[model samples]
Target: MSELRKTPLHDIHQSLGAKMVPFGGWHMPVQYSGILDEHRAVREAAGLFDVSHMGEIDIKGPHALDFVQMVTTNDASRLHAGQAQYSLFCNHNGGIVDDTLAYKISDGHYMLCVNASNTEKDFSWIKRQCTPDFDAEVTNVSSHYAQLAIQGPKAVGILNSLADKDLSSIPHFCFDYANLDGIDAMVSRTGYTGEDGFEIYLSPEKAAQLWQSIMKAGEKDGIKPIGLGARDTLRLEMKYSLYGNDISGETSPLEANLGWVVKFHKSDFIGKEALLGQKETGIKKKLVCLIVDGREIPRPGYEVYLDGRNIGLVTSGTKSPSLGRGVAMAYVENGLDKEGQSLQIMIRNKGVEARVINPPFYKKST
Candidate 1:
C-alpha cells in the first residue's frame, strides 16, 4: 500500500481535536471545531487552514517560458515577474487534466501550484515534455514546502503583525518570496474564497510557528482554525469548482464553463487545437449552476431533467448555509443551459423543482 502523507501541522490539528480525514492521499483535518462554526468564522472573521497537501513544482532556466507555453493553454509571455495566473492543462482532445496556478517568480523561473491528486501524473507529464533542447528543470517541491492560509476580512492586519515586508503593495494574484519571521517564505494574495486573503508557503519546519504567530496576532479578530469541510462550502458558495468532483481528466474547460482559463492566442499549447475545434463546433455538454426549491439537497450524481426529459447529472451540490437554499452544479445538455431556465433534480426518486441561475448563489456585497 502507498504511504499516506501528513502535513507539518498535523500535530497541531490533533492537539486541537480536529477530525482528521483521508483526502487525496493525505491525512488532513476535515474540521477543527465544527464545519458550520469554522465556515462562519471565515465569513465573518478569519480562519486558518493547513493546505500543505497541495503540489508545487518549480521550473527554472532559460527555456522556462517556452516549456510553459507548450504545456498550458494560457499565454505565459504576458505575465510579469511576481504575477500569478490561473491556467489549465489539457489533453489532445481538449479534455482537462487540471486547473493550476502559475507564478512567474523571476525572469526565467516559474512555480506551478497544482491539485494534490494530480501531483505524480503532472510531474511525469512535465518530464516527458522536457528535453535537453530546452535548458529547464522541473522539480517537485511539494514535500519541501508547507502552506497555510489566513483568510477573512482582517487577513491583512494579521500578516502585518508577523511580516516585516510591506504587504499593502502586494496586489491580488501577486506574490513575493521573502523571509517571514526569520524563515524563507512566499506569500500570495490569492485564495479559493472570493474574500481577500493570503496563502503563505514556507519550509515545513517553520509551519507550526508561522501558524501560531498568525493565530495569535489575529486573536483580536477571532481567528479560528478551519478545515476542509468549510473550505468546500465556502468555495461552492462562490461557484468555484473543486478538482475530482466538479472537474476531472475526462472533463474539458469548454464543458466546465472555464474557457477563460484556456487562451487561444498563445502560439501553440498541448490542447489548443482541440479546444479551438470545440469552440467552432460548440460543446455538447456544459456545466451549469442551479438553485433547488425546498429543503432536499441535490447531491452529486443526482439526475437532472428538463420537461421530463433526462438532461444532465449533478457534479457538486450543497445546502448553502449562507443562502439557506440548496444549490447545485451540474453538466447538462448545452442547449438547455440558460439563466433562469427551469429544471428538475431527482432527489430520492422524486423530482424536485430547480432553476438554472447565474453562478455564485451568494455574491459578497462589495
Candidate 2:
C-alpha cells in the first residue's frame, strides 16, 4: 500500500500524542486524550478539529452559476453572496457522486467543498461535464488551504474573541471574510457535528499558528483538539451522512433522506431524469436509524433482518456516546422501514434486537 498523506496539522497531532490512523488515504488522528473524553468535551464545552484533508474546488466566470446549477442537485440561484448550501452531485443514473457544500462567493464565482477521498474524481467528473460552449473555469485548489472546525456551545464566544469582526451576525450557513488573529480566513457558521460552530478556511502556512492561538485563547473555556473518533460519533449522533459509509456512488440522495436538497422545479440537472423516474417508480430500499437493544455494537456490513429474513445491510453503526446505546444507520428493504419497527442486526453470528427510528438521536440543547 502507498504511504498515507499527512495534513498540515500532522506535527501538532503527533506532539499531542494522537493515535494516528489511515483514513481516506490520510494519516489522521483517531483520538487524542481519548475518544469518550473528547466526545464529552465537544458536547459540554468546545473542541477543535483539523479538517484540512477536505478538498476545495473553485469554479468561476460568466457561466459558473449555470454550470453549477446543471451539475448539482440544489438550486444555486437561491444562494446569495457569502451564503453556503448543502448539495450533491449525482451520476446520470441517479447514484450519488458526492455530497458537497456549495459556497457562493459572488454571482459568477463559487467554491465547492467536497470529500477528500472523492476530490480528484469529483474534479475530473465536473471538468468533463463543462462543455466548451460554456465560459467557465474549474480549478482543483484543495492544497491551497487548511481547514479547522471549532464546535460546541461555547464555540462562538471563544472564536469571537480572536476574530476582528462579530461572528454572531453571520448566521447559520453564512460566511464572511475575516482576519483571525491577523491571519486571513474565510469563516463560516458550519460544521459536521450538529453543534453551533465555525469552520475556518485559511492558507496551510498559517494553520499551526492559528491552531495554537485558538487553543490558548479558549483555554479558559476548556477547548482541546479533537480527533476523528469523536468526530465520527458526534456526526453519527446528528445523523450526518458520511461519504463512502452512509452515502456513496452506489446510493441515491432520495433513498438516503436527502430529498430536501434535490430541486426538480429548476432546469434539468445531472441525474434529474433518473431521480424523477425513481420518485415515480418509488425507491425499493430506504435508509433508517437503528438503536440496538443491548450493548452489542452494530457495525457496517452486518445483515439486518425482519421476521427472521435478511432484509438489508448496516452502513454505519456505533455505540453513541451521547445516547449510551448502540445506534446505527442501515438500508433496509422499503416495506420494513418504519419508525419504531423492531428489527434485528446480526453481530458475530447472533441477531441483536434493534428498533428502527428517526434520527438526530441526540437533540441539541436549546
Candidate 3:
C-alpha cells in the first residue's frame, strides 16, 4: 500500500494527543479531546481545523473564465473578482465529477478548491477539457498553501484579533488578501459547518505559526483544535455534502438536491445537455434529511425503505451532538422525499423509524 500523506499540522496534532487515522490518503486527526466535545465547541464557542489536504488548482490566461465556465455548472460570469461560488464539475451524463468552490481572482484568473480525494481526477479532467486552441494554463497548486478553518459563533472575534484588517467586513463567499499573524493569507468567510467562520489559506511554511497564533488568540473564547470526526458531524448538521459519501461521480447534482448550483441558461457546459434532459424529464430520486428518534443511529450504506419496500440508501449519518438525536441524509425516490414523509432505515437487522425533514438541522446563532 502507498504511504499516506501528512499535513503541515500533523506533528502538532500528534503533540496534542489526537487520534490519527487515514482519510482520503492523508494521515488526519479524527479526534482529540473527543468528537462530541469538539462538535459542541464549534456550536457554542469555536473550533479550528487543518484542511490543508483539500486541493487548490489555479487557471490563468485570457480564456480562464471561459474555460472554467465550460467545466463548472454554476454561472461563473456572475462572480465578481474576489468572490467565490459553490459549483460542480459534471460528466457528460450529468453525474457529478466533483463539487468545487470556484474563486474568481480576476477577469482571466480563477482558483478551484476541490475535494482532496478528487484532486487528481478533477485536475486531469480540467486539463483534458482545455482544447488545443484554448488559451489557458491549468496549474495544480495544492502543495503551496495550508488551510485553516476557524468556525463557530465566536469565530469572528478570535480571528479579528490576529488579522491586520477587520474580518467582519469580509462577507460570506467573499475573500480578500490579509495579514494574519504576520503571514500573508487569503481570508474567506466560508465554512462547511453551519456557523459563521473563516477559512484562511496561507503559505505552508507559515502554517504552524498561524495555527498557534489563532489558538492563542482564541484561548478565552474556548476554541479547541477540531478533527475529522467533529468536522463530519458538524457538516452533517448542515447537510453539506462530502465528496465520496453524500455526493459522488455516480450521483447527479439534481439527484443530490444541488440543482441550485446548476445554471442551464448559461452557455454550454460539460453536463448541460444531460442536466437539461433530467430537468425536463423530472428527477427520479432526491436527497432527503431524516431524523431518527432513538439511539439506533443510521449509518452510510444503510438501506432506506418506505411501505416495506427498499427505496434508497443512506449517504451520511450521525448522532448529532447539537440536536441530541440521530440525523441522516439519504437518496430516495423523488416523491417520497417530501418533508414530514415517514421512512425507515434498516440498522442491525431492524428498521428504525424516521421522518424526512429539511436541513440546516442546526442553525447558527444570529
List clash counts for every candidate, in order.
0, 0, 0
In terms of lDDT, the best-performing candidate is: 2
> In model 1, what are the clashing residue pairs, if there are any?
none
Q: 1 or 3: which has the higher TM-score?
A: 3
**Whole-model lDDT values for every prediction:** 0.88, 0.94, 0.93
Tens digits of per-residue lDDT for model 1, 1-366: 587789999999999999999999999999988988998898888899999999998899999999988888788888899899988878888887878899999998998999988988888888787888889999998998899988888887778677778885799989987566676789998998777789988989999998888888899899999999999988998889898888987889989999888878768888888889889999999999999878889999999998889999999999887888899999999988899899999999899999999988778876
Tens digit of per-residue lDDT, candidate 3, span 198-307: 99888999999999999999999999999999999999999999999988878999999999999988999999999899989999889999999778898999999887
| Ten contiguous residues minimizing lDDT sum, candidate 2 | 357-366
Quote the lDDT for 125 in model 2.
98
TM accuracy, model 3? 0.98
| Model 2 quality (TM-score) | 0.99
